[model samples]
Target: MKKNLLIIPSIIFTFVLLTFFYLLVIERNPSELPSNLLNKDIPIFEAENLIKNKKFISTNEFGNEIILVNFFATWCKPCRDEHSYIKQFNNNGIRVIGINYKDDPKKTIQWLEKLGNPYSDIPIDKHGRIAIDWGVYGIPETFLVNSKGIIKFRHVGPMSKKVFKKINLLIKEIK
Candidate 1:
């Protein structure tokens, strides 16, 4: 009986240690930045437009237009919630492009239909390679790029009117 009691405590201790190690060491902190690419040239990516599915979208498509690149996923609630703000940005003459992160074309289409499409162009990043290139750690991140293709601002979560106003000011400054 004493041996069993000791074994139970040992097992509990081992489990606690393993849990601590997994949480603190093995798992990565989600907020960690792998690189400092902000305020630099927007990374170029080539992806198929989710709407058309025939043509490809690349950095070159932006041309001289200031671009707002939004990284979103169909499953993300915040991405759905931010759709109206994105529409407002688009209506304000800000060019908006969407990078659909690791989502199915059919589901993406359905999500857009439900939320109302706000993007001037929506590209499918089925593998998330483009998101990795842009240093996106989470969905619903946005980057404001200038006409020259330099990233001027990055917002890492659901956008609001206050953030939109700041982006608008940056756009005016860049223009």
Candidate 2:
């Protein structure tokens, strides 16, 4: 009985070790949060435009071409960090809309002016209701939408150079 018990614990230990090794070998980001809104139509939202004198209607703005929606705030360092990649998307002819999440409009405008505005429309989410509707948990979250207004991918947190390349590939893959 003692020998059998020893063998059982040894087997369990080996199994656990192998499991950890397998997880380590996998090409995955442990920090990445899977977006629940993937492959779903973007949530309908309407908000006042920061620059324009009118409200931004989701129905009219989207569904014609590829759109990139970025939840950003002037206070978020990561938002600042990913500004260049966001601009790159805009430069590639993608219509990018920025949801200014709970940020001061004046500060956001100043920041955009300093960093170079990449967004076609800056929607004011003064109370973060729009972000909540879109299932946003963090600042600097980026979503790629197709011509049909369906969200294809969501990247949470600051986008790294690797993520920039990965998103670029996805942009090409989309029609």
Candidate 3:
């Protein structure tokens, strides 16, 4: 009976080790973390517009057409790196709402002016409340919301060429 107990525990330990090894070996995108908000309606909130001197209300901005909601900050290097890709999305006729996350308004304006703004609306999230509502994991997160205002896909971190292509394809598929 003593040997049987030891053998059973050993077997279970080995099985768990193998399962972990399999998971580590399998191909997976670490940046593609699952989001609780995926496939759900965007969280309702309103904020002052950074650029247009108007209120950026959640109810008014999302339902009519597909939109990209990008949470970015001036201090984040990755956000700067992905700015070109964000601009490309806008240039391709994708309406983008750039949420300025916990950043200084003056610096954000200067950053956009230097980078060439591509966002249709710039909402100020001074204390990161909007980002919290959206369940943003970090700066430079992007969400693809459908015409009906439901979030379809989310990408975290800097946008790379591969990611940009994947998003373009997703947009096509969504349409």
Candidate 4:
């Protein structure tokens, strides 16, 4: 009985150590966005406008303008951090569309009100299916789609001054 008890504890210890090692070393990082879809056509998505609620907007609605599709949630702090940059994009003639991922409408509206809504059209993705179709693993991802509706670049976190500069250059190049 004593030997069995010791063996069980040893097995548990080994399992714990292996689990930690796998998590730290073998597991892939979550922040890395897949590059396979770059330069590909943007995914088709039609969602209810979060602001208006009654209207639906899709990829085809933006026409030939440079579209910035931002996947965010009201609870995401990084999304809030990038709101000003989105506003800047809007001011610079880029059409910014918001995809409110898996959030309550009331909270989303409240968050937008507090952050100052910069999205030309805010779409509600209450089930997050649209985000999944776009290969989004996390919140606050921004995709830059060209006038032809091809995805040119994807910004995977809160945009910084440097990132915005880079994005602007890409936008110009795509145009």
Identify the candidate with maximal lDDT: 3
| Per-residue error (Å), model 3, residue 98 | 0.2
lDDT of 2 by residue, 30-68 (tens): 878788889998999899999899999998988889999
| Candidate 4 C-alpha error for residue 10, in Å | 41
All candidates: TM-score? 0.76, 0.89, 0.88, 0.78
Clashing pairs in 3: none
- Superposition error at 80 for model 3 (Å): 0.3
In the range 1-175, model 4's lDDT, one tens digit per residue, is 9999899989999999998888888756555757567988887778888777566646556558788989988789898888899899988978888888899989888887887888878878889899888888778899988888888888787888988999999988878
lDDT (CA) for every model shown?
Answer: 0.83, 0.92, 0.93, 0.83
**Residue 13's lDDT in candidate 2:** 97
lDDT of 4: 0.83
How well does model 1 score by local distance difference test? Answer: 0.83
- Deviating ranges (above 4 Å) for candidate 3: 1-18, 29-32
Against the true structure, what is every candidate's RMSD? 9.5, 2.2, 2.5, 8.4
Tens-digit lDDT string for candidate 3 (19-77):
99998999777556799999999999999999997898999988999999999999999
How far residue 167's Cα lies from its native spot in candidate 3, in Å, is 1.3
Number of colliding residue pairs in each model: 0, 0, 0, 0
**Pairs of residues clashing in candidate 1:** none
Question: What is the descending TM-score order?
Answer: 2, 3, 4, 1
Preferred candidate (lDDT higher): 3 or 4: 3
